[model samples]
Target: MELDLFRWRFVHWQFMLTRPSNYTAGNIGGSVSGVKIAFLGNGSYAFTVTGNSNPDGSIYNSEEAITSQTTGRLYGAIFVRHWDSYITPQRQTIFYGSLKKDGSQYALSKVVNVLKGTNLESPVPQFGSTDNFDVSSSGIAFVSKDPVLQPAIFTKINAYFVPLTDFTVASPPSPIQIQTSGFNGQATSPVFSPDGKQLAFLRRKSVQYESDKLQLFVLTDVAEPNSTINALPTADQKGAWDRSPSSVFWSPDGKTLYLTAEEHGRVALFTLEPPSVTANSSSLPKKVFYDGAISSAYPLSNGDVFISGSNLVDNSIYFHYDSTSGKSNVLSSNAKNGTVFGLSRSQISEIWYPGAAEGTQIHAWVVKPSNFSATQKYPLAYLIHGGPQGSWEDSWSTRWNPAVFAEQGYVVVAPNPTGSTGYGQGLTDAIQGEWGGLPYEDIVLGFQYIEENLDYVDTSRAVELGASYGGYMTNWIQGHDLGRKFKALVTHDGVFSMVSQLASEEQWFPDHDLEGPYWKNPSSWLKWDPSAHTANWSTPHLIIHNELDYRLTIAEGLAAFNVLQQRGIESEFLSFPNENHWVLKPENSLLWHTAVLDFINKHVGLPTYSEQSSYAKQLRSEAWQNRKGDLGRKV
Candidate 1:
């Protein structure tokens, strides 16, 4: 059924693109006359079918349709803006935009501000809409700021609602705050039940040591005019913290709620069942879908769902999950098309290995060479991800593509060890204040596991590479006994010293990860500081740093190179003066990749320079000059 719908939609889109003469100019400025299909948060869809010019020179909507085919209903449009101008100070606000439908034609109301003269500061209010607003059926209840209270006492932004009927006049009514007893952090992503009697939202708490922990709450009796908006008691489950929950959606029956969160290294679907009683419940949220991290999900009236996410091999694809059969079917192409860029024929697989502790499992992604054979050995390129709290999701990346390594005849392994998100919050928080502890051990064990299990992987000819947190890990690896494990190491924009890294622009990162300032926890700084262990470093290294990287600072990379050079250890530094922490420009990226590949090839016995690809040779020359005459040394 979804396949047919997709085909029809594809045909319609193609037809709309071909027939340029049929589209008339819209009042909204751009050419928006074509049928633009937009999915609403209420599990339904809307489209601007056709447009026609009115007799008075103004354009009138010839056809504007909303689908009532789903279990959800459409509310009036809500427009939100981050108003930062001379007239209004920097503040985030939502406006009510009424919808008037006449036959197939509909008109949108002029936006009326929901909050007027409200001095709300940072940690702004969210209307549960990144794309479309999460509004009640009557278009009255919407998520906004609690305007009655100033941001001084309540430093955290709280979620509130304003009814549509309150905007009969020019001035809008004050929003009613949803009260959560223990939660004082910002509230966002409010999802109203289909019956419009209950509201579900996430409440987060600001902690000094780590990220804000989010807990799901449902407000009952929301329809009552003078109801005391108390959230139902929820369980405080450890390791259940949400890692980037983007959207909140309720089932058609309103008994179940679905959301996607990073759990143990993938974005998996979680289901929460609101307790029947108001008392604190011990029912924990269960993970329903485990295939991959679901970026977005849209539920249908017939208990089925449409999801978009990435897996081990493929990047982004659409799937339809049948609730009855408990199975999912692909609805989109297996791989993206139309790109002529010669990508390698690589196969990706998810591998689980023993972690730092016994019986503990760590997840890693392996990308093998195109013509892979068990009889032939291949060098390994270990790629680490950033975020310390981030995971190597089964997603495609242009910057650190593992396939590119495979194209060079090297097997690539990307791991989401301890402290990586998508596993569980407990695992993510494990490395807090212990950056070089369990996570490092996990990476070592992951590599050892691959060496022992994969016969085709030549671990002795391996190179470890990473950027950001991964860079820090590479630096950390250089200082530990693991330095002897790899033939070479590459660090890009990595942290060299804990105390020096404190000079980073984002103080919150070190503050949260290190458990406070360096002065406050000098022991923590000394324990894992890579600079402190430079005496143990012996491996050949390549250091890459960007001048615009204020996060780790250019000094971090320079310091690492200085130590290696001062000690007479084989080392090279490549500086990108015009780039940031990431080399984003196309030409710069080509140079970066060429330099990295050259370094890897020199160590792994591959052709250091490819004459067949003149473009690559030219990039290698440019990158060598950027090395500041250091290319003469044995790489």
Candidate 2:
């Protein structure tokens, strides 16, 4: 077999937005034969044609981009999904190319560039931040910047028609207008109907900071924007800024539009009939369905719906019927091992993955006490997710610290609430900008559901814990809803004040999040700041943050801690000296988990859980043996 190096510069390994970079292999199948590895940069990578096997034990007789960098740097790069890759002579980078299982090459007509001096001003870290183009199986339609249109949010968020064949963008493309002056909110999820004739999207015309309200707009076009179009605000739903739609998806037939909205912090599903190509604004909006506290809803190919709910015991995704059974089934109930056990049968509590809420189809693991018994209910620790848009899946981690708490008799429950991905795009965008609102309610309701439904859980001994966005929610609970309900709260790398997060990292504000900077709308910042209710905090809190975290800097954590202390509230602050946003080193992770278990135990009156396990003891013993010669003499 002949092997081919994917690129001339193996050292410059590039990561794709959707897949891993096995540059050693020219294609997605595996390493090719006759390829030799060569170092392009001080051995950061190796371009070779040899019989090198991957982690799966398959011989990879091809080139490889192995990391020769330090763990801190390597892990950091992988964390951000940036890798080395070749830059084309056209000055085009892989960032514009699409790679799929089948070899096919397609490029964007023009890359979306963040205007200089804009929020996307910061250069990507040592590892680049830009993602290589991703080709969707079905073609896509986007709104692009045209000097004439001058879309308010961008020069353009182009609506290039990506053809499924060869996955190429159509030439002389048709474009749409996404942003215009006086728009309250940014444009979100542009979805075309199944027939590709109608389009639906959620737009915020304006965002009010104090009340956290947004003006919603829905535009429809029968053919293309170039043709006659019917664009206007939706009158089907109330026009209140406080209750704007978050996610919009079209049915397979293009007859229905599914939307998720937050009402008093609870999410509900609403189906409406969007205006047709021939119909004008005269069509009335009708709600075909409704579910209070619906976390997420996904549309499947067959028209069945997969809904990941926020209700307890109902966290799993449910398959709703259009023609099939009216009820949904739980997919997570199929996993056999609820808790992972180590070599000695001692439960490795941290190894547990969570399942979806009880009735939904999604699945996640729960870490429970090694010595726990049904007779003695345990205090529950709810591990909140950060991305608020990310999912809690079954995977291994060295830092989650679940086992440490489980060993101490704490029932650790991590839920894949609404807004988590892997379910579908509709579910993923359900909580945009509605922070401290429905997003917050889903979590609280989840905890309540677990306490009421799970026989092994004790409501009186519950705690709320999370990092980053999860951290933000933990702090929110301390001041808004669960201040008195939760026995203790633990926030890691979370935001206390949105104003500070936006101001501290101004360069990141525009592109990644925030329609504009804090200065443009300072009230939005003040309204969402958890510290605004600091005077109301009653639960003891433990604030953990990394000194070097660029996302949520230590200063943010310190400010919140200081205010809590000043108010005579019970709070403690702990900072990682050399770590970043996520504490990755295994030893450091052990320490972090141990400290969390200790803190929660102290507050909840549970017995202390030792951080040390048999694995730790064995590692220490090996270390001592290696250092025996330095002892000078045996004791």
Candidate 3:
């Protein structure tokens, strides 16, 4: 969409020469593929395209092979499969074309590959998008993982500056590397200044540890002439900063930088001057605003910052903050969160309980049902967050949402344990080599704190659930004392074995978390292995695994389910073959929720899913049949 800033509206709405059916919508599935990125700049346009077809629009023969007849994958390298899909000859790449005029609308002409001659992939696989690349008037800067490194065990992604010479160059000029002073991690979130003179990005020190602190850097003299095409341009790094920034962008004046980092379970916005301005000041980076999670903060030319964010109750909110006046004006929000959905800020709160470690306080979000009453006890729905490095932030989510579960007549307590981010880096780093030790104790202590203090929460009738790392914790709980406390457990895309987890595509993850290879350090992996305690597994379990979850793989969940069955423990297996790590489709999400809720409801002695729905239906049916009499009696 091209906007006319002067008029504060759109001039030409359609940018595509030929409108594609759908890039991401579930409906209208025929003759469609996804458009990952569509960038318009410098009289040329670029896009990241994904499909089974070639440049000539010819479908690949390998993709058309008969799967039922004969099939086998023979490969010699790591990352043969990453994230969701198996390795294919074709990978998603950036394509560029001339910005042509289609009547009154601006559109892209027939395009050519940007990384044609290079052994690089843009919009980095699995979890990257428009932010992975930035376009300016002179060139395009993008971050791609080390082409020669073993992606399974190493993580080093560098930002490349492509000085554009032509839109249809068969092989574009060799892209130069924007060096980050020997940083060995992904140089992500590269953002070009408004004038295209400078590029700011974020990088880390450790390649293997994905959760390492992201240091901010700015590359100056970006448009300087270079005789050597792929020359390395040194970037200025911010070393004194303690917190890792997730997003980075230049201020409107181009003298300062704005960043957002997770702080105390909140994504706070911060502003810092460039090193050249004044580097040694203790107050270099100052916190701006962080009531809820600030997803985006755009500095206006007039000094006000436009921001968008959400909290536990509100789904979405937009506001503009004027630092001069120190005031925030609400532009828009999901007012319907309360008016239509009957949700309120009062229903959600926070509790900081002592963790297993002395002086270690773990934060948790406590959500009560809309009609909660202190006189009555409510079943506890304890939610564990994934990422171990990830925290249950003050934000809204579509999946594993605490609000949705609370609305279903339960009190949701989602805890951010020892390893959770947004807290100090020390707590997060402490989880290293002790994934199942201290963090597990933090979770246990968190529950114990609730049981002993939260009077209205019935911990005995609780359902503990989580996905990914949280899933791994639930699996760990199944073989421990905490499993006995919950009525049932739900584990989604979780790891069941420590040794078997090395089979995952990203070996660097288990490598770092477990400290080393299982063969080299057996105790490091074995001491925390969920499989080691299978002899103690007696809890009712709902295991959910997807076929495309290459992180943990389906084997983990299947192994857990088989163990449950062999032990004659009450368990059910839920599989989504079409989905990946998450249930994306609407219908699939509905099924996922139903299966999970039904299993938990059954174990907790609450009404089953169908029973709850049927009872509600019966009430409506009886009221409908006697509407006239009911109205007359009421009158």
Clashes of each: 9, 56, 0
Per-residue CA lDDT of model 1 for 164-240, tens digit only, reads 43222456665666666666665666766776667767766552322455567666657543432323332553224
Which candidate has the top score in TM-score? 3
Candidate 2 lDDT over 455-493, as tens digits, reads 888879888789888898888888886768888889998
- lDDT for model 1 comes to 0.65
TM-score (C-alpha) between model 3 and the true structure? 0.84
Q: Give one digit per residue, the lDDT tens place, for model 3 in 363-424.
A: 99999999999999999999999997999888877787888888888999999998888777
Query: Worst 10-residue stretch by lDDT in candidate 3?
Result: 1-10
* 1 against 2, candidate with superior lDDT: 1
Per-residue error (Å), model 3, residue 413: 1.0
**In terms of lDDT, which candidate is stronger, 2 or 3?**
3
Deviation in Å, model 1, residue 361 alpha carbon: 2.9
C-alpha RMSD for every candidate? 10.2, 13.3, 8.5
